[model samples]
Target: MKRGLLFPTTLLLLLLLGTIHAQPTPDPLDGGDYAQVYARAQAGGDAVTASRAAAAMTEYRAGGRDWTARAVQAARQATTTRPGDPDAQLALGSALGLQARAGGYTLGALNTAQQARAALDRALSLAPDRPDIQAVLAEWHAGAWAKAGIFSGGNQDRARTLATAAARRAPDTLFVQAHAGIALSLIHDSQARATLTRAATLNADTPLERDLQTQAKRVLEGLKP
Candidate 1:
C-alpha cells in the first residue's frame, strides 16, 4: 500500500513540473502586433490597410525605439509594395522621421533623416494638396535646420512656407496643426505658442490624431519664455 502511494505521488509531482516547464514565456515585443497587420495588408495588396497599419505601429510608444523600428520596417514594406501610393510614402517618411528623432545625431540617425526627407518629398510630389504631408515635411525641414544649419542645406524659410501652406490646407486637422506648431517653434516664431496651444486643445478624431495632440501638448509645455 505504501509503495503504491509513493509511486502515484511521484508521478503527480513529475507531471506538475513538466507542466510548469512547458509554459511559454511572454514576449517583450508583443506590442508590435501592427507588424502582423501590415503583413496581412501586404499579402492583400491593400495600400490603405498597409498605411494604417504602419501608422498604428508608430503609435505604439510604450515599446520604445524597438517598436518604432518595427514601424519603419512596416512602412518601408508598404512603400515598396505600392510605389505610387502617396499614403505609403507618407507613412514611411513619418516612421523614418520618428526613428531619426529618437536616435538623435548619430551617423545612422542622420542617414535615416535623409531617407525620411526623400520619402516625404516623394509623398509631397505625389499629393501636393495633402496637408498632413506638407506639415510633416515642414517639421522635417525645421528639424534639419535646427540640427545642421543652413550651410548643410537645411532651410528654415522653406520650413516656414511649408508650415503655412499646411495650416492653410487643413485648418481643422490636429496632425497638421501640431506639426505646423512644431515647425514654427523650431524657428522660434512668436506664433508657435498660440499654434501649439490651439493644437493641444483640438479634438482628435483618431488614435494618430490623439498622439499628435499629446505631442503638441508636450511641446507647448517645453517651450521657453
Candidate 2:
C-alpha cells in the first residue's frame, strides 16, 4: 500500500515529545468558551493554561502518569459545557488514551486505544471530512497499534492503511503528513523517504504542526536497519 511520513511536528515534538503539551495558567471561565480553553491549553506553562495543558500531557501518555485523571476531569468540563462539541469529545478521548497508556499492560493500552477510536469515530461521524479529527485519529491509530500483537488489534498493516487514509483526509495538515511518515517508517519499506518528504513539506504555522514536521525530518534521517 502507499505510505507517508510520520515525523513529529516541531510544535508537537516540543509539547508531545516529552509526552504532553505544557500548560499555561488556568483562566477564568468566560461563560463556557471551550475554544478559549483549548487555545489556552496550547500556550503551556502559564498558570491559567497549565491545568488544562497538564491534563492533555497526562492523556497523551495514555496512562495514569502525568495528569491523566486531571485531564479527564478537565475534558469532562469541556464536554459538559458544550454537549455536541466534537472537539470536546476528541479531547476527552485523547485524555483517556493517556490514562490507558499509563495503565501500561498491552491489553490495557489496546482497550484505551479502542475507546479513543470510538470517540474519534463518533467525532468523524459528526463531521466526516474534518482534517483535525482525521489527523488525530491517524496518529492515535498508529501509536495504539504500533506494538500490538497481530492476535490483538495492533496490526501494522491496519495502521499503515489508516495512516494513508489520514493523509488523504488532510493533505495540507502537518499532523497528517507527519503521522503518515511514521506509519510508513514502521512498515519498513522503501517508500518511507518519499512519505517523510511529504511530511517535511507540510507548512506548519502552529507550534504543534511545526514540532511534528521537525520530528518527521529526524525520523527520516534515522531510518535504517
Candidate 3:
C-alpha cells in the first residue's frame, strides 16, 4: 500500500512540473495587448485608457511605420471621443510629433508638425499647469526654429519663453529639465549645461524617462566648454 501511494504521488508531482513547464512566458508586447486596450477604451468611452494605449504603442512599437500609424489613429480616437480631455489631446499631439520626427524635415513633416502644434495648443489651453506638455511644446518650437523656412513657422524667442516656463514649473521632472536644457542649448544659454547635468543625474523610472536622461547626457557632451 505504501509503495502504491508513493508511485501515485511521484506521478502527480511529475504531471504538475510538466504543466508548469508547458506554460508560455509572457511577451513584452503581450501579443499586441495595446490593440485590445485601445478597443476596450473605445467601447467603454474611456479617453484615459485610449491615450495610454496610444502612448504605449508609440513607445513599444518605436520604429515601425505601421505602429506609429496605429498610435496616431488611437490618439485621434481618444481626442475625438473626449474633446475636453487634455491628456487625450496631448497624446494626439505627441503621436503626430513622433510621426513628424520619423519623416524628418520634409514638407509632409512640416505639415504634421503644424497639426501637432495645434493639438498641443489645445491641450495647453485645457491644462496650462502641465509641465510635461509645456516642455514638449517648447521642444516643438525649438525644433521648428532650427529647421525654419518659408513653409514652417518657428520662433526661437517663443521657444525660449516656453522652455523657461516649463523649467520654472517643474524643476524636478526629468522631462522638463532635459527638454528645456536642449532648447536652451540651441540658443547657447549659459545655464544649459547645469540643467542637462541635473537631468542626466536624475533616476529614470520609465523607458521614456531613461530616453530623456540619455538625451540630456548627449546634449551635455555636445556643449562647448
Candidate that scores best on lDDT:
1
TM-score of each: 0.74, 0.62, 0.72
The models' CA-based lDDT, in order, is 0.79, 0.62, 0.77
lDDT of model 1 at residue 49?
58
Cα lDDT over the full model 3: 0.77
- How many angstroms is residue 23 displaced in model 3 relative to the true structure, after the best TM-score fit? 36
Q: After TM-score superposition, what is the CA distance of residue 140 in candidate 1 from its true location, in Å?
A: 0.5
Model 1 per-residue lDDT tens digits across residues 110-210: 88888998999999999999888999899989988898886334589989999988887777777788999999899887878888887998887555566
Can you rank all candidates by TM-score, best first? 1, 3, 2
lDDT of 3 by residue, 75-191 (tens): 787787788988788888888877887788688998898998999899999999888788778877777777764356766787788888888888888879998888878767787
Candidate 1 weakest ten by summed lDDT = 25-34
- Alpha-carbon RMSD of each model: 15.5, 14.9, 11.1
